[model samples]
Target: MSNTNSLTEHDHPSVLLPLLYESAGHLLSSAGALTGEQLRAASLLPGWTRAHVLVHLARGADSRVRLLTAARGGADLPQYPDESTREEEIRQGALRDADALRMDLETSLSGLLQAIGSHPDEAWDVPVRWLGGGRRPVRGVLWSLLRELEVHHVDLAASYTPADWPAAFTDRELRATVARLREDPAMPPVRISADGGTSDLSTSDRPGPLVRGAAAAILAWLTGRSDGAALTVDPPGALLPRVPAWRR
Candidate 1:
């Protein structure tokens, strides 16, 4: 999750590109279990249908491809024209038939894979701007794709759940989310503990409220994907700070 290692083997295009591919495969498999009619039903994300989630996932891959392609060829590009345009694109695309939606997803994933595969090693270090105006090496886009695929796969409201996430992904995301909280002055300084484990996400030396749960459960709470009602908060019944929405 510490994607700042632009020139390191960890964030290398060769490494992240394949991870994104496997994640895409997992997302596509979850999608495969849905019927065309089911696509019209509501997803875990409020006001979003299963089709909406699928559309966004497909377009997201294309967006990453644009960023990586520009990095490889040394051309200037933006992931989307603007937020409204991106939403509108997803809005229109969501109305497509299930077959067409799946096809578009596969097509977009292929395009991104090809873009990553064709890149030279040196090109991976070229700086690219993300939609939020933050910039990182081209390989950062691959890490972005990982969160998208994994999180949205669960948001599809199908078979995948937070518990379904691989232990490595869960552990990494937990650390990253904790780091994000630590940097935010407005975020409460709470202590997060893995049940029976030593890992703690605390900002200050003086520990605050203790939120105890498994790694995946704790992550879900931190990411705003879960309310953490199931987790045990120390002080016997104290309320945890309302976590701000997860950064996109």
Candidate 2:
């Protein structure tokens, strides 16, 4: 799930940068609307509050910005120094008041978007080091940021949900998730048919269950954002295959 496809027009900054801005704007509006009590409430993510999710989103933007800067400077740098520091930072930042947290989210995302916008077109092809010791090009970083903003926006338990994701993003994300899970040993052996079978992928050569649903619904189920209740198994009354925790 940490990997990314080769750069294409789809991954170009011109396309993704605008989408990122729109996503961040929606997330900021949602964050700004949160009451102090709501901010303190637990998020969809286990053991993380709405404040924690917001803080993590803000920090994630900064981390990506750092990677882009490093790439531009011809220096390789991880998104963060280490995982412990990243977790601690999120924990500490989550304690801030709602107003401060919202401001931080807006500021960090705006700065990150600006950095991405200013990046030279050719620089986007330069590879950068990610936190998990993975190397992805600068365009990959942009895609990752978009994925973070859209998916974590839902994690905030705000108005945003998988259904609210743009068609392009949902399709691309479904493809990315499918590519990641296709060969994952932990994934269930099943044929996933999205959009009434317009798109299809199977984890095994042999037929198993044919799970069918809308693309967003399928992506949500695959990413652990929802139970597979919206999906239908081919065999009548067949149980949905259990999937391991989502890596993305």
Candidate 3:
């Protein structure tokens, strides 16, 4: 499991690198036995096949490598020319046979791991432009890749589920997600309680109904990976408030 202990305002690449490797290893190992038919099956994400998910994962790794390279004083490279190009790449790559897709993913993962591991200590603080035109430190890029691997591993919907997520990841992600939602102007006013109120947080300043559930379940719901059926709202079965769409 990845050590999410270092996931702070300013992350540490040394700490995050090991976790990234672990996450990638788990994802690759879990999907190792997928057949062509299985790869063609729809993933948890709407309209996305397992092959599409795998291709997207691989492409994301390559993009991170480009960012890391630029952070190391190399020529700046665009993660992609544009959003259409990215979607087209995923669409085209998903048409490959199972072995081809697996090999592409493995290669991309190895390349990214090498880039991160061999990065200079001083360069971690260097900022690089992300696909969305926002700048983040090399360390942030590492953390983003880690998140991608762990979350999309469950998205594959083969054997992994939210229940299999590491406790460190679940707790950290839930808190981080709540914190983000708190700042969303469009977010509904609601109090979120996890683990039967052991952990409670309000989404906005204004008070509203309380939605409570297990930590993993709450994280899954907040991330749009699952419906909130496992969660219960206060006011004696009042409908759960519609939360703003989660940002990936």
Candidate 4:
């Protein structure tokens, strides 16, 4: 879905918050169902295991809480700790038995939901700096957070596939990812196909390439999980390299 399809200001805070909460809850439940060995299984992310992904999820929730706190006029939130530090924290915290991990995830998720639920509707208008440049309304930021959880939940590749992704999730996330890639100079021009239609995207400010496939497939390929092999590309050589990292 493109920005045009994004939730309007009036619908953002009220509608998106519960969606994000539910998505997070689903992810935690899925992670909790994994056995210790399963949790340790390798994921698509280079060397990270399922445990590492879960750790990132937990930390990410904490970070969102901090961001929301800052937007509410609390003191400056601390910068995210370095990757190695975070990885180690996840290694220690998420290596517990399945039940323990579930408990921990539930606790963290509860805190996040409570933080969001406590805010007055007016708080949605406050500006918050997103991970990317520029500030967006708190509602937009919250929606972005929901997008993060849904996208990464699939990245875990344990229970869901790109095709299985929620329609609302796919629409919002694909549009954001494509728009961001189109803006970055480091990436190349590429055509994205979704829902049997094609969207040509270019690195330049002008129009993008036109390619044809499912929207979820385009999202998967762009994120480095699926190669463009599944879609048709004109001048086949024009496709760009996959993104080096998924958005944090």
Candidate 5:
């Protein structure tokens, strides 16, 4: 479950980290409720089991640790040797025993947190570049990690859903997504609004699709959490326009 915090324009990651830990703790407890068979059951991610989801979550932390460390020490290191190797590692870890999986997840999370804590206050704002190539402040890694945990927690398909998302996170993520969509060459020019005319999510001048809904519903649809089932689209129940994989 997510915290009930709201986002402010000046919110800081330092203040958000503990609440993210609480959210992760909640995710772990939910995972704990599953039996071994359930752990191996297929998740909402096509071809991935719940075990795969858990292991991916764990591996994500490890990858982040590598990035955080490089940011702190100003060293050059790859987040993973390669994407193929990363996938293989997840596959191998997913086959672990339930207890081993849990232990691995715990270990990964703690290790990354320690890495984050190792940074000097000034180091946190230093730019870190991913092996695949994009740079952002070290503190940005924390937000990405939190997004990974919270989003994949839903992907496990055990009991969580978008409704469990924190409003602040949803709002922030949704705004960021809209910014991306505006620049996306593939995304059709359209107008998007939520909450009865209070929100404008699109910057396009072209008159195309008009998607209107509650904030969470629009976020869920944009992020591939749903198929736009409950949203009101122009042309009436129109299918959601295709978009690239989310940039999370």
Candidate 6:
């Protein structure tokens, strides 16, 4: 599904909000099926386990609630905590069995859904700063939260992959992540291709060589993790100077 086509003005919190809830539900349910030992098994993310992943999901859901609340003009919420704190909380709290992780996820998901449902329509009009430092409409925030749940669900790599991600979800995230990277001064000037299309990403003010790759692959690479390996660039030196430290 095209990013623009999937999200419309009318859908508001109704469409993406429920999808976020349902996606988290599916992930937690998958976690529930794992054995206690399996729940403690290591995951693809460096130094994280299945329990850590689930705990992070739950904690992330709570953070999103704070973000939404801040968007709606509540007193400043803490910035989404850093990854170290997130992993530490998960590591410390996830010592128990699989059942505990599942329950924590379900509780967090429930609270998030309830809070989203309680927002007035005008709350959707509020402006918010997104992760990676960009302004997004409140509806965009909702869509972003939905994308997070779906992407991280795949990140769990329990029963899902990029191939299994909902097309609308991938499209939205790919577009948003790309747009954000384009605006970052620290990142490189590159060309991206995905869904059989290419986007030239370079600064007119800081003209330099172009880096070319599949948009999906580029987006994945930019996000610091992607399962696919289709990306290829020409005259590789052209991109060497602009590659960000994060990508290195």
The candidate 2 region of ten consecutive residues with least summed lDDT is 1-10
Distance (Å) between predicted and true CA of 201, model 5?
A: 0.8
**Candidate 4, poorest ten consecutive residues by summed lDDT:** 1-10
List the global CA lDDT of all models: 0.80, 0.85, 0.81, 0.67, 0.76, 0.63
Rank order (by TM-score, best first) = 2, 1, 3, 5, 4, 6
Task: Compare candidates 3 and 6 on TM-score and give the better one.
Answer: 3
Prediction 6 TM-score vs. true:
0.73
RMSD of each: 2.1, 1.5, 3.3, 3.8, 4.2, 5.1
Q: Which stretches of candidate 6 lie over 4 Å from their true place?
A: 1-11, 67-88, 127-141, 196-218, 232-248
Q: Which pairs clash in model 2?
A: none
Q: Estimate each model's TM-score.
A: 0.91, 0.95, 0.91, 0.81, 0.88, 0.73
For 120-190, candidate 1 gives per-residue lDDT tens digits of: 77777788766766677877776667788888888888978898886757877787778777877777778
Residue range 57-117, candidate 4, lDDT tens digits: 7776776677678778854553244556656777787667767766677777778778888
lDDT (Cα, tens digit) per residue for candidate 2, span 1-248: 45465777778888887898898889999998999999999999989999999999989999989888988998877888888999999999999998899989999999998998898877877888878777777677788888888888889888788999988889878877877777788887888888843468777776789989898998898888989898899988888877778642
Using TM-score as the measure, which candidate wins? 2
> In terms of TM-score, how similar is model 3 to the real structure?
0.91
Tens digits of per-residue lDDT for model 6 on 99-146?
Answer: 777888889888888878887777665555544444445555566557
TM for candidate 1 is 0.91
Q: Per-residue lDDT tens digits of candidate 5, residues 115-224? A: 76666766766666664666666666667777788788888888888878877677777777777777778777767787743468674667777888877788888777
Model 2 spans with C-alpha error above 4 angstroms: 196-198
Which has the higher TM-score value, candidate number 2 or candidate number 6? Answer: 2
Model 4: residues with Cα > 4 Å off, grouped in runs: 1-7, 79-85, 127-141, 196-209, 235-244
Q: After superposition, how far is residue 186 of candidate 3 from its true place, in Å?
A: 3.0
Look at candidate 3 and tell me the lDDT of residue 5. Answer: 31
